[model samples]
Target: MHKSFSLQMGDKTLELGPKPLVMGILNATPDSFSDGGDHNHVADAVAQATRMVEAGADIIDVGGESTRPGANEVGAQVELDRVMPVLDALQEAKIGKPVSIDTYKAVVGHQAIQAGATIINDVWGFQRDPELADVAAHYNTPSILMHWDPNRDTSKDIVSEMKRYFNKSVQIAEDAGLIKGQILLDPGFGFGKNYEENFTLLNRIDEICALGYPVLVGFSRKSSLGKLLGVEPKERVAATGATTLLAYTKGAHIFRVHDVRENYDALQVAHATIYGPPPAKDI
Candidate 1:
């Protein structure tokens, strides 16, 4: 896999060196599928974010809306209200880490960048709102395009469709004035995949990673794990850790996860076993 990668958002810069990155999930929503309503308040959000960073998070991803199955949609203002306080609190606390705004709305993303977010992680992969590509370009923030479609057709090959979507997403970003290096691709595990397809994507992640872009995979507490192990979201941490190790060895550059320390620890061992020893500070 090609190694050079860099991203800039607000005043923060993220460079993917040798080891994979641990992006801690900070859902500031009331109804996330996993860990929802856990960090809705400012105090709770800050506390959780602090714990994540202390536990070895390289980045904090804050999302205001819950995209869980059968969840209600929140308005932009509500999302803004839910997210700004936490982002502001994190900035004020001086965590010295890059903050990622997990939203597809351009206005919400704009407000997030104004409040100190450096990354835009859109689960729709810019297929929802083409204007979101413009927002990422406007702010010059690094963009993560995760494969997702509520009505995705399962008849076709999922990985090939994901590659097609990435190609289109890259075009959208470039057309909107965003550079290729500023873009990252995500297969979006458990978003629109079936039990077998999720693992198929995982097994072929290295092929996707070989397409010449940084790959970010989110298998943490996903329903696919539950489908495989007959466990619930909270019980999927060990499964998530296993997936993390597998994804890392397959050349995934980032792991968006709920349990930062466990994933970080697993990646530490993976790095040692495969890529050599990481620095004490990195683990």
Candidate 2:
């Protein structure tokens, strides 16, 4: 069985377990690999977030910078300018879900938490800016650390390398005062892995979950899916749902995705099939 966690995010308590949780991806940047410029405006982003929540998203992850391979990196000020408004607007709109800031910069993470983001999702797994861990620790928020190292030799066992990378990330978090419950691990689906290595990582993801932290997988609309299905990012919802089911069976605790309702429906069916139907509600 997958491990469960109860994370305290400001006034809210996020429960991750039993059934998988869906974290809707809200990329406020204009250059994300998918959905770029889709929610660049504050009103559009808020509207999309509300739709995701209504569609059963458990969390909303707001990212200002594009971390896609070969995408130009934006500075901290630029990222803050792009993201702060959305964070503020989401809080003001009261989306009723913990908002996660997707960034690898310490400064941006710091200000984002102050701007009302309750979770810190570092794509670089604190390797890019170790100080980001400190920010999460200081705010006492849950942090999702994803394994990413483009320079690593992919010829080696990718799972082993990922574990080693996560070991360092966990140490950084712990050293920065973050406890086990405040941490989540991601396999970094397409970030640093080659085509085969990506599949190998997904196949061996249970090993990462075996490390004792809730595993969050974000294979939604990734290029890997595109390459496999010979489709564009916008057409990969079904493919993304397929990975969601596979990862769910493999003990993954959270799924970060672009398409919320499809994945939510997929998880509901899968959970019901494995664990029996959920308790019915009164009319």
Candidate 3:
């Protein structure tokens, strides 16, 4: 229903909806579930981001906070310290790809946009702080509005509830003077829901995609995948690839993942299957 859309960052315009785009994850947090603490420094962050770009990432998502379930929240200043230097380094390095800052704090979001982040991947889905919406609007940064039910310690009709949550958040974002082109929707697969809830949402992804915005599906090494496949975090690569392929089939325009190459390959196969072979090019 989005009628085919794309996001413009710098001189590049990334096509979305008609096919899936890979959003490689680069976590600078010391405790991220995957590759955490490994890229905490600015140099390492730049290297990791560069590697992802080489692996065919359409967008690089950089996060300083570990949003793993039950992770203790860090202060805004700490988050800023963790992310800004890497952001500065990435810009200085002339990274060609658009960078997306993964944060839920308004101050961090504001500074990240100033630091050259063109996208805001808010895990809280604009529910954590009222100021976040204002920050996003102030910068006019393209934001990924994920489905997060702020109903703590409750798990009732999660899929339906999340749909409602996304609708309200979308409305609020629109009211904040954010253009439709600047908004993308994410289902927040493991944010506040149980395993069953996650699958139900996954099976019905089109319901969310029908909201008339680009859909971002992120389930990389998530506990829900582990629970379903009975595997550990390190063993979720194959499952992650499968999920990315499924999401592509279900109209997902973007995939946030740790293994960029695997998802990139999986997307190629999915695209070929869905739309026949690519046109022949002059070598």
Candidate 4:
């Protein structure tokens, strides 16, 4: 297993796999499903970003559009307008953590990088906008490529599908001149899979992680969790925590989540019990 790896962006390095890195999700859109319209305002967005960072997040994933099911498509300009203020504010305030822009549009991703985002998180796995990969290459920005098939295929084994999906994403990145080390793979928890498929993907996350790329699990308040527990997305913190622990043990290197503090605390205990003590001089 690739137990340890780090992605460098300027002077910052995000170490992975010693324990799962917490990537707090900050959607500055009006329909992000969970925090939709909550942080649409600049001040609210900045404050929430600060709060999540202070609560022990390793990264802040800021999105301008909502990827919730049935969500309407947003233009690049609309997306940019929604997220720029938040990005600018965070940059001005020096949030002290790498900010990842969650966008699949090339123009938006490029602008976000120029505005100070360190990583590009494309939920379409680099397929929706081929230019998105080019943006990453141009900026040499680290990327999180999520496994998303618009078809939502549930007929096959999801883990195998994930491998195929990631393989394609890697090729797309490479074809655009993005290096292997600059790419991270996400299982796309609730993106295209059904309830059973999501859990199955979680249960066999090791196969996905075995791809030798850092594996990021974004199962925070996902619809799959809500459906399984019969709770709403906002009411699924406990369920999210439970999945966080499971994903941690299966070699998930990063968690794209909403409840940062709870996942941080859960991982600390799991890290201690499963991975044992930290290095004598390490935190």
TM-score of each: 0.95, 0.97, 0.93, 0.95
What TM-score would you give candidate 3 relative to the actual structure? 0.93
lDDT per model, in order? Answer: 0.88, 0.91, 0.84, 0.88
* Positional deviation of residue 74's Cα in model 2 after best superposition, in angstroms: 0.5
Question: What is candidate 3's lDDT per residue for 180-275, written digit by digit as tens?
Answer: 788898999887778887788888888777777888999999999888889888789999998887777878889999989999988888887777
Better lDDT candidate (2, 3):
2
Prediction 1 global C-alpha lDDT = 0.88
Tens digit of per-residue lDDT, candidate 2, span 68-92: 8889988999999999999999999
The residue-by-residue lDDT of candidate 4 on 43-103, one tens digit each, is 9988999999989999999999898999999999999999999999999989999999999
Better of 3 and 4 by lDDT: 4
TM-score of 4: 0.95
lDDT tens digits, residues 97-135, model 1?
A: 889999989899989888998899998888778888998
Which portions of model 1 miss their true places by more than 4 Å?
10-12, 278-283
Show pairs that collide, candidate 1.
Answer: 9-118
* Candidate maximizing TM-score: 2
lDDT of 4 at 270: 85
Q: Look at candidate 3 and give me any clashing residue pairs.
A: none
Q: Who wins the lDDT comparison?
A: 2
